[model samples]
Target: MRPFLLLLSLAFSGLLAAAEVTLTNGEWPPYLGQQLPHYGVASRIVAEAFALEGVEVHWEFYPWARALQMAERGQRVGTAVWTHSPEREQRFFISEPVVESAYHFFHRKDRAFDWQRLDDLRGLRICGTLGYNYGEPFQQAERDKRLQVRRLPSDELCFRQLLAGRIDVFPMDKVVGFAMLHEHFSAADRAQLSVHPRALRSDPLHLLLSREVPGNAELMVRFNHGLAQLRDSGKVAQYLLDAQQPLSLAP
Candidate 1:
């Protein structure tokens, strides 16, 4: 009787555990947005991947920094749509690559500049989002004073500064930059901005589970397995296509 009761209790606990998994996120549109269908591309892929594993997901949106903090502290299971960094690797178990993004420089059409190498940015006033990791070379250049960087609160602000001629160039994800341009600027204003032909860097984004979370290692395994299945099934590509269609229709 005692053994039977223990087994029943274990089964009930397992059922409760399988009911849901929570993830933290921020408003990074076309990739992850609260108002977006399925909460945008990456979010859709993540949801489908977990669904394949018979797990339900609950997403909590917060400021990017706060979201990362919640995941790092294990206030939630993990944070999605994050780029892997050495520091993040130390604090979290990163899942398989969910998506890749190209980081490119954008400048006013009349202020076109060529970038063959990092050295070309010297003496330029560059704008970037606060708390973002552009890339190793970019960071090193900043530390070595190769260029002057001004950090702003959002991509919209960066573009606003560019239009006002307060900054020379800003680096942003290619897709995100275009989306922001459409969302924040009129047709005439958008026509004045152009992304550099050369990309500064390309990075893969992943879901990062905090080391502080119990059973996180197992969760990572499950997520990767499901993500692999989704990719193998061609669902990943479809999700991206769907995300782009809406943006293409944007005014």
Candidate 2:
């Protein structure tokens, strides 16, 4: 009878242990957005991975900088889909890659742009998003005043300036750039934009679990296990495909 009571207690505690994790997020389309289906692919992936472990995620959306600040301050469980950085790794338990992004230069087709290195962009009018890191070399070039850059508040603005001939080139994620062009611009405008065959940078984005919050390290580990399982099941690739080509793909 005592063993049976012990089993009941354990089952009850197990049910009680089924908990929800709150995560901070921001707008990064086709990857994460408040309006997109499943809050975009990356957020969906995070939610599903946690679901596999019988955990639920409650998402909180904020400005990108504020999202990072809130998560790092342990106001939430973590932030999703951030590119790996050494400074971040020092403060958070970085999960295995949630997604990877390849950034390329977007230019008008008539402009015929090409570049082997930063020096090649010396004379062109470059546009960049404020608070974005294009990579170390690009940052160094900008810091040294070797490249002239006009900073904009968002990618849409940068692309608008590019289309208006006010900006010669903008660096953006390839999949995201194409998605934005298709969704926001006309077919005519889409024809005018071209991506450089070479990528500026390729980085894997991860879940940043705050070290300031005790037990989050274990949570990161559990999330990683579920993430690995999701990857192996081939759903991540399919989800990405759907996000990238929403028009033609049947989800």
Model 1: per-residue lDDT, tens digit, 1-251?
Answer: 99999999999977865757899988877899898788878988888888887678899999888999999999998999888889999999999999998999988878869999999998899998888788889998887888799999888999999988999999998888877777778877777777787999998999998999898888888889999999999989888876666452134
Best by TM-score: 2
**Roughly what TM-score does model 2 have, to 2 decimal places?**
0.92
> Candidate 2, residues 127-221: lDDT per residue as tens digits?
99999899999999999999998899889999999999998999999888877777788877777778888999999999999998988888887
Clashes of 2: 0
Model 1 per-residue lDDT at 180? 75
* Model 1 stretches with alpha carbons more than 4 Å out: 1-17, 245-251
TM-scores for all candidates?
0.88, 0.92
With a 3 Å backbone cut-off (N, CA, C), the pairs that clash in candidate 2 are none
